[model samples]
Target: MANRTRTPNEGLARLLKQAKWSRSQFALVINRMGAEAGLGLRYDQSAVSHWVGGTVPNPPVRRLIVEAFSRKLHRTVTHAEAGLPLAAFDQAPPGVDTVEGIVDLGRADMDPSRRGVMAAAGLFSAGLAVPVFSAPAHATEASPVTPGKQTVRIGAGQVEAVRRMTDKIADILDELGGAHARPMAAAFLVNTVVPWLRAEASDTVKKDMWATAADLVYLTGWMAMYERDHGTAQDYYVKALKLAGRAEDHVTYCRTLRGMSLQASNLGYGPLALKLADSAAEAAPKAGPRLQAFLMGQQAHANSMVGDHRRARSLLAETEAALMKADNRRESIGGYNQSAYAFHVSHVLHEGKDLPGSISALQQALKVMPSNERQGRVHFYAVLAQRQLEYGHLEAACESWARFLEDYEHISSARGDEHFDTMRLRLKPFRKAQAVRQLSPRIADVALLKA
Candidate 1:
């Protein structure tokens, strides 16, 4: 037989040419897409050249290329049509892809060694511009089944049970801290929720299950943020938002965006944070009073981060006003109220360098915060100590630090540890002061243990 020559990926090249994107531009788009999907791809024109020369990209990269082209052309594109090898799961339809994605995420979360998933999970600044308010494209259809799996039955009762379990877990998260509850949350999602999602159910039951799943996933993201795993946290939040969209639960969807805003602001990505917060508020204009207060407070905090003191203060006032209109109803799935509003006030004041004002706001926060909220108490105490020290109230600072240590000793939190390290640095300047001298040994002892 005569030898045959292999053909290049002319389809991809043709698409790129039609899109008016140079090889480098196409590569840049692909790289950006990969980053948004939590993959760290460093492709340039050379990579594109290889692709055009018949070399296929990896599965994730192939999907990203198709996605990039789809975005550029404003139409859906597929791997096979793009002349790329299909992913193992690509044979399934869109709804199945979503379910499998969640399942994969849950499994990765359960395994600490899967650092790629965790690392890639960071909040991309570009995501702030993406619309999260609209319903997902696949929302109205039934989720396609995985091949060869038995059609396990699910019902509203099962979904209700999951909802109740989610409530109990959320309570535990509120009282203890994410450090204590995060593993449990991940495990539950992997072992319980993922199975329910894969099981067969009627449309109503499926929708309810998706809503409950969104709530649980949102909680997981919050816990991840608490632990300072920003990447993983961002990933979970994105998933929760998608699930919320599927369920047509606008409230949870908006709340998830707000959570993303909170994480971005905390990480000092001020501009993106402000944008996400604004989007969240705009998405849920008719939301309840507590939810409105929470969103407004988030906007205020983001404004503070971006140095818009005037806007921040105005939003803070609005947040307070909104809180007053909140009903006495039990906390909804993702609701916030007076204490949360006060805490956000403290954040804004602190960011704006109003130490005394921040301290006062934090005091109010602690006053209204639930007594059993151990993690909340610790956070308030930590901030209070820092503000007291900054205001040169050494004695009061020491007292607050003592209280912080008392609460912090029982919880594992990266945020708490960051505060502790900050306190140590702040206290170094006052080593010779009587109050500092008295508190030094205790702080040092704790630091030593942590180290």
Candidate 2:
């Protein structure tokens, strides 16, 4: 091979020296960061040497490098400050900058082409790990008031109205899926909620408004994830976390962190997922029983993802015990019950390779799950089909899939579509069987409709 020309990365070298990290140590930190962000990077000392020689890592990895340095120095480190080119999108802002950042995100999401760019963006582990309040002095400071605009006055009643509307929208999302309510939620945020934030109000009312906005934004993030727009979902969750922090609402902040953990775990970043889940639980030690159960259940599933079978089982038991302590108030606040616990238990068992146990837990989940949770019902049914197929029960799997299709036809979710595609591919080999033959044409019909 011809000798490769090596350029110098003086900035990276200086930073590495300041941080007192060896080439191998730097690469190891980057690898851990990548794992937290749901990326499976396998860079070694050679990768660090290449970087020192002016070879830039991929965009996501470059971000990880900056984040690692930020953590080491206990300060915000920009890409340019770390010897890298500025990213196309500005780094996510904290405190008052969060408002502007979210507005930009909303606009981008509404643009078809820009939305595609966000949808295709990779996960950033540092984004999930760092708290917004930990940014540099200016970034964490409160926003300044702008004059000359009509001072739209806001009060407690207005905040209550927004909260009630958000609750109604959340109900719709649970019953019909994000495809049916995401647009409405987005519009409400931009048109109604943003204005209230800009309006004049007492400090107490403003705090309440921020808390309510955090709730709505978090819901939007949840809907985005369900729609398979991971990047946008991450942005929304981060913004929600900032708002919750500003309002000093520990419960909402922990809930937002838990949401991030769930998204990270589902995308296969087991280590990062576990970190986020544990962080949520740690942040809310004195939370209600229902919330505790939900957080512990999430931790259990994360443990399973990382192959900690014994710990996963123990957490699952603790989750059940927590649920047993929930009263009506706790249940209403957490929005979790026996069925929710069952669903999480099923997930943990499935991840731990207990297919039979998973199937039984899923059955229990379906029996107790409320009919209003249509989207969840579809998900559970699909998983039931998958587990049956894995166990070589072709006929039973077909029956479960048929039930899934019945519910799926009414929902418009990218996740549901993905499951349908996976089912089609898996069933291809069984086409000669009577059940598969009959289901194949119907599957094709659904695909065509989706297209």
Candidate 3:
């Protein structure tokens, strides 16, 4: 336990207040759990207070505490459920000034200890504060929508039009995956979709239009990130979130936050990823089952990166439960939403080094995902190869990598290239193997790599 760090749960008091669980009630819950576990440990209000007042319980008790509340609330809770699980606090949530939030999230991912601290807190303190944008700004006079494009204003007809456009954009992007779809999506959004959104329109129309614009912007941002344009992509996500807020589209807002979370996690910001995921979950507590499940699943993904298997598993269970209970009112953001859940779970399992579990989850994900969704398919195959690598199946990893490269080639995406290259580096140990060497040439030929 040399690397064992202590964290205090700050949100414990808040959860207690929300659930109306007094000190005695909390003690009762803990004592009941202890008795159930055959600990024979007597507990009471004072004991609970002492534990809550900065004393760390053994790991068993800690897990039990989380489970106890999860059962009581009929929802998943983390160690942060009790209070801040650790001693440190993260910087306040990002302001809407620019891509600052995205950068902050990136910083958090690179520091595992910070990740632990933020996950321990688990409160959407950011949502409670004033939003970074008070009044939406107009386009600057010199800044055309895009090079020669005219400035667009927000309106009703434009909103409806943008919605239709976004649907088409998403479809095209899905087909292209991370490769060809990246620039196509960005061109469409920048030259057409976003301009339509910023153009003149009534409040009602503007809101509707902004919703569509937000979705498209998010898609573009994700595509850009995949294409390896992180700077531009971060700006797009921030802008998308701002637009989502203007439209009062909580579901999309939450989803964009999750997207930011994914980016953070990918870049190694575990704490920021968890925080952003938490923000999404909090944004729409009543956002029906599907949306909630999606948010929880993303949080689970962030948890897995830090080797927090227990919490990750618990969240996945809750996510599955929520998804199962999701009603017919599915406000899915895109066609990939359903399959994305399974894909993400598989990803978490893969990262956790659980090959069998990863394979099982990936199968489920692939079952729902169409072969045409190149980026998603590439990811699925790439992860499978990672699992193969774990099992000393270099040949299998090579095949998967080859297929991944094939799908990856169909898209204009930088992120896809990064993933492909990262896997290549990991498989370098097998370079002497003819199979790996044979695949290396093809991977090297991918256009993004050439660029």
**Could you give the candidate ranking by TM-score, starting with the highest?**
1, 2, 3
Using TM-score as the measure, which candidate wins? 1
What are the TM-scores, per candidate, against the unseen true structure? 0.75, 0.74, 0.61
Q: Which digits, one per residue and each the tens of the lDDT, describe model 1 over residues 1-451?
A: 8756557998898898879999999888887776776777899999899999898777667767766775577544555557876566554444545554555566666765564557565544445444355454443353544323334788888898888888877778766667667777787886777767757787788888888888989888887887778877877888888778778788888898889988888788898889889988988857878888888999999999989999999999998898889887756356676777888988999889888888998889888877777877888898888788779798999899988887777766777888888888888888899888988888878877777
Model 2 Cα lDDT, one tens digit per residue, 19-54: 999999998988887777778888889989988888
Which scores better on lDDT, 2 or 3?
A: 2
The lDDT for every candidate, in the order shown, is 0.77, 0.77, 0.63
Lowest summed-lDDT stretch of 10 residues in model 3? 141-150
Kindly report which residue stretches of model 2 are placed more than 4 angstroms away from their true locations once superposed: 1-94, 111-114, 121-128, 132-144, 148-150, 328-334
Better of 2 and 3 by TM-score: 2
lDDT of 3 by residue, 286-349 (tens): 7767777878998899888877888988998888888888765423253325577787788788
Off by over 4 Å in 1: 1-91, 111-131, 136-142, 148-150, 330-333, 444-451
lDDT of 1: 0.77
How displaced is residue 140 in candidate 2, in Å? 14
lDDT, candidate 2, equals 0.77
Task: Give lDDT: candidate 2, residue 261.
Answer: 91
